[model samples]
Target: MDSKIKISITNFITVIYLFCFLIISNGTYISTAAKIFFSILVFFSMIINYKKVFNAFSLWLVIYTLFVLSSVSWALYGEFARQSASTVVYTTICSLAIPLLLINNKKDLEFFYKIIIVLPLIYYIYYLIFYDVPNIFDLRQDASNQIYNNIGLYAAYSFLFVMIYQAEREKRNIYYDVFFVIDLFLIIISQSRKSFIYIGIIVILSMILESKNVLKTLLRILLVFVLLFIAYQVVKNGLFGDSMKELLLSFEGDASDSSYVGRMNQFDISIGLFNQNRFLGLGIGAIEYVCRFVHGQSAPIVDNDYLDILSDLGIIGMVIYYGFHIYLLIQYIYNKKKWNKKNLLFFVLLIMLFIQGFLIRGYFNNYYIPILLYLIYYDTKTLKQDDSTILET
Candidate 1:
């Protein structure tokens, strides 16, 4: 194939993949169908680029997949176990296969970054015009929580991409700055505390990684916060102010907050389940059944990803599961040669994913695929020469 045609084909497929992911994140009616279609597409991509995909596959990923699949033998709910295993397979294809096959160079990566960043801005504009503006003062509806959460998550990603782009291009574009501010606004309005925290952590990490002078960076950040505070004072009497207040008050609530307390209980139950099982575990997809049978209504869900693995796959599973992430982190750190934008972006992403794992089940989440793709894409590019030499040897 001609190089241009190949690039065009890859870009088209990437667009489709992004669109399907957007639908999945937003909980659209056709999300499941989209997932199935995209999964098929990913499968085809894997077959078409089997050599590259095989070369990129790490030992840890193979081990992790086998362990998850093994859970089916001991899974209490066979159907759920099957679904869980299928999710693992789908995630592997999307995260590992697609990037290795389609995104082979810098141009492909830049194109991917641009689309991913713009996606959240588009979604935010739609929500602002159709939903948020009309119901600015109304309490946030439960049904809309997922939409808000998705927006916040996307916005966080947009921030990271914008920062990376700015750093790489060495240009201070006002448009990216505006987009980042919008992202912060969306995160605040969405009241996704975890997303807010993740963004803050990402920003701090980005500054540290990108800055030459740590003291100067800290001062600049302080100044930005001061400006934000002043802006808040000016808007404190309006609808936005009320929303901000509500968000702040959310953190002050007592123990009666079932959502907060429930998560804690779930963690406790996960530990107990791990203690009882200790080795292989009750199996993946066994959480709901175990919670209902063993703990009754006290612990119905495992929200933390680490805890979920501990309870489902036990000690062995947890080691494999977390060990993969640890290995990746070490690899990125060890490979750090320059304080370039790509390196900074990779560090920020690594920190965000690591922190997010504790707050939610990061393994099979929608964001997981994109994070892994970014990691793998950069890893390949950074180590291309080393990889080739090793293969030649």
Candidate 2:
């Protein structure tokens, strides 16, 4: 294939993948079909790149996905379970396959970075014009509810890659600067507390890893916190009015927060259910079926990712899932000398992902996990060359 053609093809498929992940979800028939189609293409691509992309991490993911699918056999709500299981499988493939097989060079990676940041804003515009969502621009109370939580998290994820992209290059670009501001605004309006906290921690850690001067880094960190403090006071004072305060104050981890309550409620329900199925789980989708179909709540019922894995996949399943994580950690520590900003940040992401998993679900479908997995098997010798060349290209 011609170089441009290959790039275009990959870009097309990737945009479809991102569209499914960020804009629409499996809940809708059209999006469900799109996800399935994207997953099929990813599956074929993974097979084609089997020699290069296939590894223990990828294999572990395949196994975990298969295990989830297998649970459909014993699921109480078998049809719903299969549909739910298929969604997980499809998303897992879409997320993992991108980093593993599609992202082949600096250009592809950069293209992906742009897609992650831009697509959701496009969707938000579409939604704004069409839907009855609150005026997020007006910054009214409950503005964040204008979009689904996961949809808003798309902005958070986009900002994540933006930071990573900037971290990779020594010379910062105004290109990323624009998106940096946009992403922060989107995150703020999303009212996702975990998104704010997660990005803060990750950004600081990446700066620490990539920093050459401790004093400079410390000053920068202090500056960040100072700005945050100012922002806090502004919101607390209702400088924009009580409604604006309500909109932004969702940043705090109030015990009575609905998202927190959803997590705890799901955790409690998961524990109660897990006690019954101590080994293999009640079968994939069983929990979602009970919660959404039976009880009419948000599907998956378990809002916590770790608990989601434990509750749906069970003890045996968690082992298969975390085993890949453990392998990556061991490799990162064992090859400390080879560590650089990219891989080191990936390691940090993995750890923070675990922490984030406690608060949010869907780590299985996060594109970053497979990228981290790819880094684990990535050649150390090439890391130096790739690091330099990425900037040049």
Candidate 3:
């Protein structure tokens, strides 16, 4: 293939991968068609690069894939097991195969980041036009609405990448600052409370990472809090004050709240399920059946990723699942000499994703695994280049 053709094909694949994140299944033919298209693109890409594909596969990925595939034997629900296995395979291809094969240079990486950021900006505009903008003071807005609120989270995640990229290049400017504020606004309006908190923490960490002057950074943070306080007061007494009161009251409500109580019950059920099947647990797709039949609940998956893994995969499974991530963190730390603003941002993002996993099912989230793989590829590529340089010397 011509070099130009290869670049075009790789870029096309990158766009398709990003598009997969934007897909929202609405139980329509169009949604189904979109998913099919994405799968075909991924499958085609894998076939084209079959020889080099395994180069991207790490020991952890291999083990996790085997574990998921093996779950079929012990899975309580045959269909769910098959579906779960398929999902794992698909996600693996998207997160590892496509990027590893296509993204050969920094330009490719930047292009991926650009698409991820722009897509979320488009989503933010869509939300502003279609959805009722939640007043800042109004707390009554549903923060847990994953469907629409997730767009904001996605946007925030992408925005963080863009900022990190800029910081890495020493190119931070007004545009990034503007987008940062816009991203924060969108996150607040989306009412994804956990995401809101995560984004805030990421923003603070990014500021600290990028700042050369510690005292100035501290002053800037203090100013930020002061401004936030002023904004809070203004919104508190504004037209949305009543709605904000309702929201605050909801938070103040204790564990008796249905959502809280339900989650607690789920934790108990997951623990019980793990105890029952100590070795392998219920298998990949057994959560739904276990929840419905054993616990008399409608939810198939729990909100907590750790608990879900424990219930479905068991103690050994948990070790494999979390152990892989812990290993990655260790690797990043070991390579501290290679650390830059960009790598620091990746580390912080990984930490944020790990924290989010405790509150929500974020372990294998679309962005999380891909980011990890990208970092691994980067490290490997850099090491090879260094070795080549040493040989030349």
Among these predictions, the greatest TM-score belongs to 1
Full candidate order by lDDT, most accurate first: 1, 2, 3
lDDT of 2: 0.64
TM-score of each: 0.78, 0.77, 0.76
Local lDDT at 275 for model 2 = 79
**Top-down TM-score ranking:** 1, 2, 3
> Considering lDDT, which of the candidate structures 2 and 3 is the better prediction for this target?
2
Task: Please list the residue runs of candidate 3 whose C-alpha ends up more than 4 Å from where it truly belongs after superposition.
Answer: 1-9, 26-48, 56-59, 100-102, 126-145, 207-253, 292-299, 363-393
CA lDDT, every model vs. true structure: 0.65, 0.64, 0.62
RMSD (Å) per prediction: 6.1, 5.1, 6.1
Native-referenced Cα lDDT, model 1:
0.65
Q: For candidate 2, report its TM-score.
A: 0.77
lDDT of 2 by residue, 102-184 (tens): 67776777676667667657766766775667656643345534353444466666666666667667787766667767766
Tens digits of per-residue lDDT for model 1 on 188-269?
Answer: 6665656666776776666555556768778768866875666456444444434444444445664545566677677777
